[model samples]
Target: MMLLDSIGSVFSVIALKPIIMLMFFVIFLASIGKSIGVRRMYVNMLVRIFEYGRQNIESVRKLQYSNLNSSDVDEVALTTKELSTDSIDQSSNSAKINNVTKLNGVVTQMVNGDTNNGNSVISRVESLILLPGVENCPSKNRDSNQQDEIETLEFNLSNCLDYVKSGMEAIIEDEVTSRFEAEELKNWNLLTRTNRHYEFISLRLTVIWVIGFFIRYVILMPCRVFICFVGVVNCVVGFAIVGLIPNKKLRIMANDYVFKHTFRIFCRSLSAVIRFHSREYKPKNCGFCVANHTTPIDVAILSTDHSYSLIGQRHGGFLGILQRALARASPHIWFERAEAKDRMAVARRLKEHVSDPTNPPILIFPEGTCINNTSVMQFKKGSFEVGGVIYPVAIKYDARFGDAFWNSSRFSMLQYLYMMMTSWAIVCDVWYLPPMTRNEDESAIDFANRVKSVIAKQGGLVDLVWDGQLKRMKPKKEWKEKQQEEFTKRLKGE
Candidate 1:
């Protein structure tokens, strides 16, 4: 009796207590403070850093030889100002060539002179003279009017140095402006405003979450556990029924009924409103059916309506056990992807499975992994190689109700199911597109892409060209280069 009381007290502390709700607000307030205080400090620091860089660039541009006479500087400045407006645009090609040669001679003279600590600066100024037209100018025009050429060269050289300085300053100014604008835009986007609607509903949603916490833990959790138990029992019964059936045809029929009917119930248990569109355009017998994979629940949604053989990787845990039950009751192929080093063997199996008239249409999620329902990733070519009609299936979930994307990297199976089961309803739209066949002499990859494009279009999802491997980790540079070379070789029939 004492132990029972202690257990009840613990349960009450977790479910009925307000401590968890208070913690949520506490963390939220702490985050608000940090965002306002620490965020501004960091942004100010960034602005200062950019300002410092701008100052350095300005100082470099303003650099002048300290030992040069004031009169020489004024003459250079006056000549540069006069020539600046129309020197390049209006000057004849011959005049420009003469100026360039004279400028080169001046640079040589500066190199041999006793210019103090401005040697590095002089070198940089020399580099700036090698502009587009300066390098290719002909030598025939180099002898025109030596006195005028000397004055023009000095003016132009000074003008070139000023131009380089202004260019650097302009670049730094643009970069700083862009950086600040980007930071401002980022801050604006990050600022979540609480409008009248949110203000009114914030308290209500908080109340709901608090109430939901208790209801989820106390009542719904137990019911979900019971439902899971029942589902496991139903699967076991399904396997046993398939095994006990005598005749081959009768067994297939019975297995179909059990698997389809049980999964339909399981989907309903999670409040999933599974709807199929264009049912009349079903896959032909002994044909291939490809679908966009959204979540593991796709299996249930598909099985409820269509009697098809699923081909997928052998998973573990509850999904694995479910796979085993599925294999027993139907002609499903659960291949171990790690052990699948022989592509030809897998292709042969797929071909054989779809070719058998007695077997149901082979269903393959050629995407090879679950995508977030926002985009259709590239399809694998293995299933597309089978010579027959291909039915493309596009699956989309209504995230307006609740997100149905199961990110395996973040959530475990049970955690994902908890979120799904607690949500309003898992709504899905499955479109069975019109059947298509490979064009004359089309490669498997091309055929797969063509089918994938159609499905992406119909489903209103982004069509990704990536091979689906980049989602795991970016490939190394050398490996990517090698792959490119190999692809080039294949295209050339090397």
Candidate 2:
């Protein structure tokens, strides 16, 4: 009895030690609750700080540009309304217009002989040309009314000197303001970085956060990697075996089963939590399913339950091999855009496949290329020409965990797969919209656009006017520079 009592006492002490330590830790955390309630408290504080900073900067900008006179009050009011309600783009446009109007008023007074300081039209033109950044300003003709007024005043033609002067003044003003605004933005970004650095340093004092970070990255990451590896192996082996099946009908059925299960396993490996939503109506025997192109993994997400014949472009490397196998297993279509004959054949194949009830619904991403998932680009007309009930599948990924956007130009297929596999679960929101039929008077392009609009609306994504091919074209210099500036700002934590 004595020996048993001693053993029980030792175990009790051991358990009590952990309890005591836990109590002490909880008390210590509570002591700091006034300054840091939780991890989320820091996030809220950071957001508040950034929001305050943005407001301050905007106020300063408005102060710098606030030069409205009694006569210009209406214009300023209009501009103020635009700035308040419209986007940053519209705000900048209003600013430019306001400046131009101001400069134009000054030019018009001088040109109308209201304030003749002995400066001739030619002298004014020369002065404008000599102004910094004005030499490159492209010349534009004035309105007919302005031209008539200049002629009535007997002012020399000389390519509408007054209009040129007004344009030059506007350009000069814009250039100066733009430079100042860029510098201000840089300062703001620097401030943001300094604040974030200080905040990070302060947060490091918390013991629990450091321990949590260590566990998440050091222990959890490796486990996730192992799980993903197992999933990949499972998929590869299953798919390979499916590829070797001799019978076409058996191969199709086997491939569908493998693909569905493999995709679910793969998603589980990444910890991706998928939620599927449909409206009151679901697509049945629709013959075709059109979806917004977000990433190549879209296929795995969309085809998890349903069997679909995929229509895609010719790919290269291992993906190309997989593509070929998939095409063979099912009645899928692959087209090379470079070959006109191939496109024609694909068009015919799509029509025939839709007509065949034995074949599954043909799934096509009419966008042709993956976008950033923020917007849906224009759809190609080829799929719409099939003239059948079409199901538009709108896919929106919650990128809070990790960005699912596959930037094809920047990353290869392997890189994208590795990215999705390594990240915190990919969360997807899939919407199966009502089946749509082409209108009697609608052209193929019109029908495509109509369906695209419905998907965009349902997905709560912006509908971009440009086609997918245009998105791949070289961007404008101004746009590239703007992107670089934004990247720099992000790096600085602005």
Q: Could you give candidate 2's per-residue lDDT for residues 424-444 as a string of tens digits?
A: 456778898888889889999
Q: Pairs clashing in candidate 1? A: none
Q: Give the TM-score of candidate 1.
A: 0.57
Q: Which lDDT tens digits does candidate 1 get at residues 362-441?
A: 88888887777767777888887778889998888865334676667678988888776665446678899999999989
Which RMSD does model 2 reach against the true structure? 16.9
* Clash totals in order: 0, 0
TM-score of 2: 0.55
List runs of model 1 lying over 4 Å from the truth.
Answer: 1-201, 208-221, 476-479, 482-494
The C-alpha lDDT values of all candidates are 0.61, 0.61
Q: List TM-score per model, in order.
A: 0.57, 0.55
